[model samples]
Target chain A: MALTLMKGSEAIAEAAIRAGCRYFFGYPITPQTEIPEYMSERMPEIGGCFLQAESEVGAINMVYGAAGTGERVLTSSSSPGVSLKQEGISYIAGAKLPCVIMNVMRGGPGLGSIQAGQADYFQATKGGGHGDYHLVVFAPASVQEAIDIMSVAFDTADKYQCPVMIVADGMICQMMEPVELPEMKEYKVDLEKKPWAANGHGFSKKSGRSIINSMYINTEDLTVHNQNLQAIYREIEANEVRFEAYNMENAEIIVTAFGTVARIAKSAIDDLKEEGINVGLFRPITLWPFPYKELHDAAVAPGVKAVLDVELNAGQMLEDVKLAVNGDTKVDLLSRLGSQMPTPEEIKEKLLSMREVL
Target chain B: MKEVIVLIGNYGSGKTELALNFAFRAARQGKKVELLDLDMVNTYFRLTDRANLVKSHEIRLVSPNFVHSSVETLSLPAEVASAFALDWDTVIFDVGGDPAGATALGRYKEDFDALPEGSLTVLNVVNTRRPMAGTPAKLVRLMRDMGRPSRQAVSGFINNTNLARLARPEDLRYGYEVIREASIASGVPVLYTTGRPDLLETFLSEGHDPAFIGEPMAIETFMHRDWETFTKEGL
Candidate 1:
């Protein structure tokens, strides 16, 4: 075990590798490119599989192939590249395949820029791929959190038979921060326990018949399958919502954001507090199944006049805040689009503007 | 005024194919079009390859040749800017897949300030199977991710129908309407439709900003028709 400085994206890759991820497939795209590049060099050294796929499409499908065999699998790409892999991601979700997907977000609509951004919030949390499915979406704002979440993501995926995404932005991917590596536990997955995997079913009668994650049988059966998925999602929502709250006591404004935007929000909140402005922060650690109840309570607190939603993209997460607050509190948006990130000073100015309205 | 077209879209939505087609059409129209390969993501097919096709029509092909084809950063060479200062009829920047590539545009954004405001069109390809393909809310978010409020930036999107092969006109029409409505809602504009080559006549005749080509039409047609259907319905 060793403590070292690592970029958020690199930490996730290294952590997953140490956690017994034997296969890695990805197409290089910005923000998240270092993960695959790192794995490309590191995986071979550890006697693992590292493939630079023909395209993002090919990379996710390759992940499906590996995951179907009950292997530890991972893929990383940026927003545009992740968009290309949606079909495969949806298929993986439908199949209940356990794998890791990392999206280092950048600004967009089309060809936006390579700078750090949190614009992919909705896409990552609301099932970016498709179908009535959910992924364990972990938003890691710091490099250490990024590494910690990788193990959590893999475990969550395995526990629930689902895919997981370590959703970070370009800042987390590119910035270097100190990390204390946890004691590495080398793992050898017992595919024998996963009878549903594509591994040959002839090993033991107790292993049962192999299974696939498709819902293509009869319409009613498909409906039943969908209902089952809904139930699973409900279970996840009930049990897995997570977040971090800082200095809410007697606070006037609760600034909400996730990923890199959250870190900026934190800095803004701190700076405002120093200036005698009571601004608090509620940062969601798990984006999907958003920490709505915490946000609701935060909004309803006395003297909490307004909530400012900050993001790299304009007003995408603001809608969710609206839904969460249900009009009990006013929601204001201070946002930047494409590759531009709102600095702490900018966010502080926004909070100051909320003074009159709140 | 220099018209700058920034080709953009989800992969498999045919942004590249449309860029190629636009290059051909713009060059054919006797406009001094410079095809700039700004796509740093996908390594394979790039606008750089069609330099001859554009050169034949006197369309200047401008791109920095990297030692490695796989490198994804598109740095606007100084020469390209020098040419831009000189009166090029149009400049097409085949920007990479998403905002990451768009960030690269920040370096050359000053160059764009020199062009007429409305002439800079950011082409959004509507592909259904891709993320945010069928949802307007998601599309709006995608726009936000690209940068907000698109008013000063993205003027319009090009609805390129799955690389333009096996694409029904209905898909093209749907993509047009959805993106058009999105643009209107966001105060941007839907410039034109990118679909099958045959449909090019329809758009050309209709004067829909000149038809743009879509994807790997032959292979993606049958399998990725969901994109076509989504684009059609969205429009």
Candidate 2:
């Protein structure tokens, strides 16, 4: 179809539908409620299932069940509601279920205001739940980027048999933009390819029964399982570390940011360029893979005086920037809590002041 | 021009944008104007967010507890009921998106019904990209649905189809074709079609038929965007 203007949440939902995600289980939570609301209307018309469960916890568990059957599944919620899905996410991770969990993050630690915030950086990149596991997280900077990543998310989840998360904030979710969608991929059940799926075979003696469970009674067996999961994470880290580096040739300062904040920084950088300021930006598209090595190179690039980490939360991504820089250069942070947006003017002022770091 | 004009449409269909533009258009013509945010739903990105801009235009704006209320409550202020008693040259009702948002107007149905004939005009603003307004049949359905809640017949149609900065002349023509068919079927005239000045300049420069698209109305975007499209793709 030709380009059409749409709310980011609705576009992402249509992207999921195009990506062959036929099963959606979610609860209503502002900023992200449009995903499930659009699904509720379009799912049945397409012979798919869209179930609004009693709670966020219930919805995620439903994702686990649907995922076990090797069907592409998706669930979305805001920050507080996403917190309730942690336990279920852990179970899905342990059981190695392939599904997508989208969070249109809002300001929070507890019932915080409904506005965009990236405070969930640690919760998403680090293991938010118990045990040694990771959810491949994609942090899209724009609505079109979010729509483009949904297809990759499902394909990556199925490829590694792991759950994935697409984290966006209200700034991107509520904004309207034009998007050219991909062709719809038809959903066909071919359990033969996913032999590990819990789908029932013909009950023939030749087909072996598959047990979809994370509970390992024996400590030694669990240890081996954990090792295998670590190996998969390593492969993902090597392959999926995607980031965008802008104006890094002989830069004076490098700013590392993601999501909508990155674009604000870009607007600042664009204006600063007119005044002969030499600056660059490094935006991480995949949060879990983190782009550590690439960021470090950008940080240590010739003529770089310092690295500025900008975010909507109180330096949540600052920790990651420091880890990536590894003390190769000094890292300063520009942060605000509670979804208070820093305009291009504020960001430019901060950048000018940060130049004193030299 | 009617004294009281109600602008209704689906969410993101540019209803609030048109409301703000209309109120300013009348106020600039040396006419007293009152703009009412009669929407009870839609927490964020409401017309109340731009009260300062409206005040500068000399148009009195009424809404829920606002003037940058951080709480973003979803109830209309009591002053909305008193808007009818004001002696303004024009009163524009900026209804929330969808037919359900007009449910709040039921309390003022008697006041609306009692208005002198032709003093009120209810216009259905449409962006045909939205499924509810995608076709002629769907347009008729939405027009009736919006009319039911406000207890007013939709007297006209406004085509406001867009795709942000990417909107081109052809998209307007395509939407106008469908909206025109909708107008014919519903017995409502195509009052006008809206586009930004830049878009309109390019639309006429491209040699599109003006008669096919009706009167073109120029409007500016009013909502806040934390960031901008800093690249050629305007992502």
- Top model by DockQ, which number? 2
**Model 2: per-residue Cα lDDT over B23-116, one tens digit each:** 9899989999999987666666788878888999988989865534447556667888666776888999988786778777766888888778
Residue-level lDDT of model 2, residues A16-130, one tens digit each, is 9999999999999887888898898779978899999999999999999999988999999999999999999999999998999999999898988788889999999898888
lDDT of 1 at A311: 82
Evaluated on chain A only, model 1 obtains a TM-score of 0.95
Task: Put down candidate 1 lDDT per residue, B1-235, tens digits, no spaces.
Answer: 7777776664445665666677666776878777777666543345665566657877777776461333444455676675457777777777665555555566776667777657777777665433235455556666676653222266566665432333455555555556655665776555565455566455445544332322222211222212123222210
- Every model's DockQ, to 2 decimals? 0.01, 0.41
Best by lDDT: 2
Q: Give the TM-score comparing model 1 with the true structure, all chains together.
A: 0.61
Interface RMSD of each: 20.7, 3.4
**In candidate 2, which residue ranges exceed 4 Å CA deviation?**
A201-207, B66-72, B144-148, B197-216, B220-235
Clashes of each: 24, 0
| Candidate 1 local lDDT, residue A171 | 68
Question: Model 2: how far is B120 from its true place, Å?
Answer: 1.9
Q: Model 1 residue B48 lDDT?
A: 67
Model 1 residue runs over 4 Å out of place are A191-193, A205-207, B1-235
